[model samples]
Target: MWLLKKLSPDFKTIADFRKDNRGAIKRVCREFVLLCKKRDLFGGELVGIDGSKFKAVNSKKKNFNEAKLLCDIYSVLFLMI
Candidate 1:
């Protein structure tokens, strides 16, 4: 609930939302995946080669530009769309 509230003021809390909201969230996620699949936007057939533990929103000094930033930005934008 803290997350939903903090991220969206309109949503006071997750508990304040109905139990059935889970279905809506799941459906939206599925629809996004389907859309990406249709657009052939899924890149990198092989992953998990680096084996480096990194924070998503950490300082840029520790993260790679062409590698980490590009991947992170794309993932975030894809989810938002």
Candidate 2:
């Protein structure tokens, strides 16, 4: 926290730093990942599960089911023909 406060760079400075060091950062990250792999640090199977529940803001009127989607597709196809 103290370090962050002391070297509190603006958005432009942060962006420029990242842009300039993009290649070097990528190389460093690749090396780090390779080192971790060599040490068997990662699991055999990586399972990423995002258990995030989002509330549906759209009402029934604004929502479209499979049947409605199929109907719309067929209507467009027929119109094109």
Number of the top-ranking candidate, with lDDT as the measure: 2
Candidate 2: Cα lDDT at 9: 79
lDDT of 1 by residue, 5-78 (tens): 76654555655564659788888999998999899999838655678885687565765767777888999999
* Candidate 1 TM-score, C-alpha based: 0.40
- Please give me the total number of clashing residue pairs in predicted model 2: 0
TM-score for every candidate vs. truth? 0.40, 0.49
Of candidate 1, the 10-residue stretch with the lowest lDDT total is 9-18
Cα lDDT of all candidates, in order? 0.77, 0.91
User: Candidate 2's error at 15, in angstroms?
Assistant: 0.7
Off by over 4 Å in 1: 1-11, 44-61, 64-81
Candidate 2, residues 1-81, lDDT tens digits: the string is 696887777999999999999999999999999999999998878777899887877787778999989988999999999
